[model samples]
Target: MTQRICGQVVRVEGPAFRVRGTDGTEWHGVVRGRLKKGKRTATAPVCIGDEVEVTPLSEGQAVIERVLPRRTCLVRRTPLGGRRTHGKAPPVQVLAANVDVVVIVVPAPAVRSTVIDRFLQVASSGGVQPVLCVNKMDLVPEPAARQHVAEVVTPYIRSGIPVVLTSAATRQGVDELAALLRGNLVAFIGPSGAGKTSLLNALCPGLDLRTREVDARGRGRHTTTTSAIYDIGGALVVDTPGLREVAFALDEKDAGDPLLLFEDIAGLAARSRFQDCSHVHEPGCAVKAAVACGELDEARYREYLRLRRALERSPSD
Candidate 1:
């Protein structure tokens, strides 16, 4: 008879996963029948940081019996965008699982904040913390660009989320960022040239992680080809391939709290004459008033409105 137990997966190796139990021992195991049965909830069913039930078949090997209910899941949208839901079902894509924080990295000087906004919106929709990391600050040479970065990230910080500024080159803010991810499964996400890998190298040196130069337009070549987790002392950090696009749609069920993500809009939205006010062009919109009265940056407010629109157009009805 096999002894059944429960553990959390710290790393996913080819066919075997490194699972650590509450007792602090390690087991190399394979996914059991139940969890292997294809799940659409996440990009990868056996993602790093997943808590699973297992049965030990050997001294160092076990079979995963079940993946326990996750407290938080971090996911992204498909880049191809062929599916349609039109009030039917959500056209969502899963990226990872049980991530306490979704670290959304973005290159500096991105005028639209599209990359950052899109990731934060998804994190908000997934009930996870979106930690905005503006990487490559060392490369952003202009004062205006730096100002834009601060402006775009101010709302999230004011709302109690921590936005970290980092530069792998000078090891700037590396310790602070590492502390945030310590003891929690934090996923690093960003487009190709946002310095995700560089930051990883800074935080965990001696690994000699590969890095490529970002093009003139700030596009970086892919250095990370898969989603892998690294153990730093007692913490787990997941480094994934460079992302090109972040889907704006989320599942119809248990989608994240939009009000919480865009908390600033709540005041005006509730007071609007229309219960269904989109807040874009609605009359008597208080959200708009705040922006005009120097309460919010024009760009930041626009990004919020875009997120609200993306949510509305989401495949889930």
Candidate 2:
């Protein structure tokens, strides 16, 4: 009989994976022949939150033989990075598996609705709940900064997305965030310098994930290189390295109605003169009218257009 043990993958480093067994023991494991022989098509055969069968090879060592089924997975086509890949973008990178909620962290002082929209699309495309977490509230304590944060998150909140204002530096809203994530597996994602790690440290209290200051350019340096999962009380949190860009492979069905992704805009679009209104320069377009009347945030409308164009340019378009 094989000495097989069931475990969840906490993180992956190159070809090795850190798996924590149901017995609460962790072991470094390598993928066995089955996984390496094209069992899965993802760029990364294994990812954080993956449940797998590990066969112990020796003390404190094991080999992953089979990956159990995942309830949900967050994936994105990674942009070109580091080495040249001959002009082709990398295959779908599985950010995490079995995630219940994807907390999209955005910094207030430098929030970009485009980034938030892209992550929203990715989360919905992967069948996961998306939460907008505005981190670094400490930087926005002043009235002007507070107003900026409010303005940035207003659209998302109106769209029915859960928005949490957090400040890892001052430990503000950390308790609320913890409660929201309790009894759930959540993944924190955002651009490089959005304070994802700092927020995690604040929530867990002793993880001490490395932190770095945003440079003079107002961009955050990469402090997390690999995705790692940690058990904070009853909640499972996965912290990932900052993403510079996000892409979604939209097909005809997906691209046919980009407005559907924007809840608030979609509601207005439902009242448009045409059933198939593109919401761009279309006559009697309720969505456009909302933007003109100042009922919708112009920035969000522009982001909608940009994402719509991106979808229109998809291979299926």
TM-score of 2: 0.86
TM-score of each: 0.84, 0.86
lDDT of 2 by residue, 1-317 (tens): 66799999998777888999988899999998767778454677888999999999888899998889989888877564633245554467888999999999988778767788888877887778988998888877789879877877887887788899888888888888888899999999989899999998898888999999988988899989888888887899999888877877443366545775787888888899999888887799998899999999888898778878877675441
Each candidate: RMSD: 3.3, 3.0
In candidate 1, list every pair of residues with a backbone clash.
43-94, 125-256
* Per-residue alpha-carbon lDDT of candidate 1 for residues 1-317, written as tens digits (9 for 90 to 100): 77789898877756678888999878888877656566554444676678888898878888888888878776665555556545544434556678888888887656346566777777877778778888878877789888877887776776677889888888778888888888988888888888888888888888667888978866788888656678764568888788787776555554433565766667657877788676678888777777789876576577676666666665443
Model 1 root mean square deviation, Cα atoms: 3.3
Which residue ranges in model 1 land beyond 4 Å of their true spot?
Answer: 38-43, 81-93, 109-112, 214-218, 253-260, 295-297
Candidate with best TM-score? 2
